[model samples]
Target: MVRKQTELPEAVTIAIASLRDGEKSKVGDAHDLLQDAVLGRQGCLRTDKPQPVDWAEAAWDEFITLMAHDNNHARSIAGQVLSNLAQSVPPETALRDLDKVSAATRDQMFVTARHVLQSMWKFGLGTKEVRRALVAEFADLFRISGTEKNPTLRRFDIVTGLRALFDETGDDSLLQTARDLISLEDDPTYRKKYSGVWRDLIDR
Candidate 1:
């Protein structure tokens, strides 16, 4: 059993502060430190299994608040970290904040939006309700992506996220959904690229 932590580590606290500082010089180092701290507690984050962190209870609120920070970097970091913590925090908490984190995918800065999108697949590792809600959210986002800048890229990420969720849950519907979305890509080159994402799954 993991011992619950009651507070953020000093370094993590300092890093969060620096990230909020809005100074470019401090942002980089702060990002590195906070990421390291999160990864250290979360273990191999790429796994389908949820690695609940001891400190997540202490850190969730702060990260949730930072998702709306004025600095895009802070928002990006908050979204990514919150996605990582989805499996660690209570299912209700994760479900409650899901839309807030999803909002970051529409951040004004495309890079920040992409960062949030890339990490959001992890939320599928939460409870069944969260997973279903996330699929619905991704579907809605993909359907409306045509009006967004770099629609193809946004579609690619959405499909990629679905593939990730499918891989983790062995959900056939998710894979089929991804394939169907790929078929809608009018650009042959991009369609092939999107298809490549499921190559291994197709082989299986």
Candidate 2:
């Protein structure tokens, strides 16, 4: 006999619905619930270990769709959750959807963009190809951020994200690329600020 498929956890289901709700009041609570749910299963955010979740398969497409939702809050939540879900999904799936995730880094709302940018390093926890794709995406972001408002801060985030990825993967090439990107900074003050991100890593 064919058995019935199990349902997603009630909290996850409600959180998704509330996030999609037009009422702004519901979003904050929903975001908190969804984040907690994903993190409870994800364990420490710094680790590269994959703790696959049953709900990830069902929620993956929904989160991807919400990345382009009308509300910027929805977009931000979607982007952040997608990054958290990266390790839960197949490595190839994460690599395939990298561009979609990267697009959120340019969201019209600067806060939304920053949220996405800061979370992107989580994608590097996947396979080597995923890490390679993440590095390429970071390189492109660093190149284009020069014209954006608060370019230095954006570049700082990119460099710091590379550091986080390097920390998780122990990949020397990632660390070298981050230092190389820092060297490209023309302003001494901003370059110094960027370099400081690596001081601890360098010392170790």
Candidate 3:
């Protein structure tokens, strides 16, 4: 980055160092100095203007490093960055180095995916293509997660819930999924939560 006539290289170096630790990213009220240093409020960062995004771009690994930061909010910021990039960037550009992000981010990935689903759908995932993709990805997750050993299949109710919320087919297919998941359950706990997912679908 091009340094301003009066700016010292060492100070910019120190600022970037603090940013890497996430200490300077508070986005706090000391806007005038922060803007001058990073985003350049009144052209304070003549040469360092490009460095902050560059730092963020580089700190992807650092973000993953901070994934287990003692603070959950810090973890969330890391996930949000991944989520934002996933939504706006082409899969090719955003995921070109998936191997780097994937192995490190297994836990954070689901949290980000749920954010994507919620932010994009703003309701139950509807529409054939969207539900198709959700089913492809999340159906299995929902199925085996609610139980263990002889795990109860919850994908059926989840899919049915989507059909009902969307009023899509609301048909035999959804009904069959319901039956399949319920039949796997010997435990009576699902007699409520699982049943609740499909009661309206069954009646309709």
Candidate 4:
């Protein structure tokens, strides 16, 4: 589905170039290119290899500034890229930018928000403090997003993110918090739908 070039370094280069264009209101191309680089095909990134970490880390400073771009599109892409680079850069960088990435979870574009939240696990990789913070952040967001119109799906997405983190870290606290959040849903049908998300995790 991603028509863009699949090479990691090349993709990061194109994404950064598009980000520059984004500053000038030329985000259409940049947004699309970055999305392909981040999302890849069938929800899997094309450049899922270890090499992308170096390329992504090289562009770290650019991403930090881009996360603050006036364009939400740029913020969305930057959040995803920074998350991807978390494994390569100092864990502190990701920890420091956690707020910026978390803010993207509330982006007006639900899809953009979902992307940021989904990739957040990268921020916590190999770090317990960051992992605990991430779980708490999602829990807080899960509690807050309840005010939104379609809170059920929002909560479900939060659980999905938690599952990813839990899978990586094997932290029971994440699982407990995920279950706690799921219990908050009022609509029985929707609650049941969402509970199915935890079935495997709880069973495990």
Best candidate per TM-score, number?
A: 2
Say which prediction, candidate 2 or candidate 4, comes out ahead on TM-score: 2
Worst 10 residues of 1 by lDDT: 41-50
Clashes in predicted model 2: 0
Stretches of candidate 1 exceeding 4 Å from the true structure: 1-5, 41-50
lDDT tens digits, residue span 1-204, model 1: 233656778877887788778687787777777656766643433332445667777888888888778889888878887887787777778889899988989999999998888888888877788888888888888888889988989998988888887877787978877877787778899888888989887546
Name every residue pair that clashes in candidate 4.
Answer: none
Whole-structure CA lDDT of model 4: 0.67
The deviation in Å at residue 165 for candidate 1 is 2.9
Name the regions of candidate 4 deviating beyond 4 angstroms.
Answer: 1-11, 23-52, 55-57
* Error of model 2, residue 164, in angstroms: 1.5
- Backbone clashes in model 3, listed as residue pairs: 2-47
Model 2 pairs in collision: none
Q: Write one digit per residue (lDDT tens) for candidate 3, span 1-204.
A: 221223233433443334345554541222233344344343321111212233333334544555455444344444433322232233343344333333222344444333222222111122344334433333444455464222233333344344443443433554555556555556677645566666665556
Off by over 4 Å in 2: 1-7, 41-51
| Candidate order (lDDT) | 2, 1, 4, 3
lDDT of each structure? 0.79, 0.79, 0.38, 0.67
Worst 10 residues of 2 by lDDT: 42-51
